[model samples]
Target: MFFHLNLLSVFRGVLYSDNSQGQDGVDIYGPIDGGTAFSGIQCKNRKLNLIDGSPNRISNIDVQSEIEKAKKFKPALKKLIIATSLPKDKAIEEFVRLQSMEHVKVGLFTIQICFWEFFERKIPEFETVYNWYVKNEGFHRIKQLSVTFKDGSVEMTYHPKFQKTVDRYIIPPTNNTAPDINPYTSSLANLLQSDINKMMQPGYNSIFRSTLLLSNTIDWEQLCWLELLVSNIGQAVVEDYKIELSLEGFFEKAEPERGNVLFNPDFHNDIKGYRNSNSHLYIEPRKKILVQGDSFVTGSFYIQPAIAVEAEIKLNWKLLSRDFTDSGTLIVKIVPQYHVIINRHEVLDSTDVREEISYSLIKRKGTYNIGSIDYHDKESDYPVS
Candidate 1:
């Protein structure tokens, strides 16, 4: 956070590393007027311990000791500022003001105190520092949530449609003459498709109108079943933590995929009651404890999107813990499995011409049959009429 102040041309800050003669109470220093004079800052962390009920305060002796040490700093300091996380103390502020006046009268560096309130007020002036230091960065207490697939990929790309071979009895063949030929050709299609699937992470059936008829059913298993990894990237332990995940976009229903249910007997609550109809999934991890650098994996979930077409599923997650809270969003893209069945009437007996006609028909105005379809599993030996 101190580095943020370097933006001003009045001072160019550098970390005070000349500790061979000891730190002299100055954590950071910068030269003013071509090193003719110097300004220094001392940082002290004094946060009240909520868990132990211990009060952390900065007393007069603490300030005086640092001030005396600052006097020993080289280059003849002009100002010494103490920055601390201690709560505001009007008495301490007044004491520092009087000290500053006395030191100034004696030709010593002036002293000042910047309490927690000062930093809080300056947050607006330094948003980047505020975010990195308080909101979501720094080495302090923080919580982060991320999601991925079983393969440990943040993105999951899969087909939401599953193929189902239609019953041949529904559309019986009208003739049994020349053997039927499969018109579909495979040419590096699977290779290209494999590459497409890896871009984020990492199918065919038979004839009705002498063309080719295939059907695909909506597959919820493919759309949902996403893996979530909740990490406590902070340097503190978090307790009584619960994660809420809301799913949005192109989905009909969503529910946790079962398993990994963490029960806190002392809290008298299980992960079951956290469900809601708003496509929200909730999980309270084991013992409700998330420690520094530790992470837990939540159970996968499943959601059903609209049958066919394409789908984009977004998972927005928020983490609430005893000492820390954070929120983030994750995206899951889905390529709904589908097929195009073109209608082809007998035109020419030539095999190549018939195949070209089918391809042209599909490329132009093809018919789409979604949901459960009545298609014959086997193609007739001959074209019908």
Candidate 2:
């Protein structure tokens, strides 16, 4: 309504009062022609009587009481306007005129009653204020959310360790086996040894990359890095906010070895994510107060997903704030990175090569079976029974 009053030029240099204790019954006050004297307005909104279709009237006594209160206002009001939603009344107008004349005669301020008819006639002249309050147009809030990746793309690539297996042959210390050592098996051992050294590096242990990964139990601080940007494009402010995020897609159970691995050691300093029984994570706002046209970026966090095949994942998010709520979904492309890791070697059989050797790789996924291999040399002096 201040905008409406501005357009009507009701008062120059108008200012709204705090309306707190000892306001002197003036909701708004302003100067007139740069003079010492000021004019004030007191608003009274009254409900209409349902049976009579008439608003509760303001009595002459009520006017007299407000006039007394306005007299206490600083700068000394030269005129006081009592604005109400109630329709006009002839008795009230006549009472106000007689009271104004009587007050003017005694060096008091003049009194005026502005009824609903005064504003109703001028509303159509100003479309902006009219549409805002009456038509409920041109008023809305815009919510936007964006995900930030290290490589500036929606796809996340993770290379988890795969169970390693090695094959080795030992020649028995005997007089007959001394000169028949196989060089092929010797070179194979050296190759497997080199692969084992690479697995001991840092990236091989990158298990806590994402908090979204399915785990029976995981340390919240060990998850991988995932960042998000939140923005508010409305005119109002958002305060006391809470955000909920959940990943939606098919997830395979991760191996216990991979699930227990920790990501960044400094994750303890940031806000820890709370995961519920259903795998939904609740995150607190880093900034408690979000003003209009402002944006905030969340700290780096982990998002672990246990998926073997390439697939599209949806990040469903919801924001809750004081008197406002919003929800949205973001699509993320997840590409699984697979690297062969030779963990350990197993001795299939302890007997001589004349005996058959057979074995299978243990605790391994996505590997073709090496099956059984015959170690017995056809031309060797040892005869097969």
- TM per model? 0.39, 0.36
* Weakest lDDT window of 10 consecutive positions for candidate 2: 211-220
Error of 1 at 126 (Å): 25
Report the CA-based lDDT of candidate 2 relative to the real structure. Answer: 0.54
Question: What's each prediction's clash count?
Answer: 2, 14
Local lDDT at 72 for model 2:
92
* lDDT digits (tens) for residues 291-344 of candidate 1: 667766665567766555467888777666543456777777777543333333
lDDT, candidate 1, equals 0.58
Q: Give the TM-score of candidate 1.
A: 0.39
Residue 1 lDDT in model 1?
39
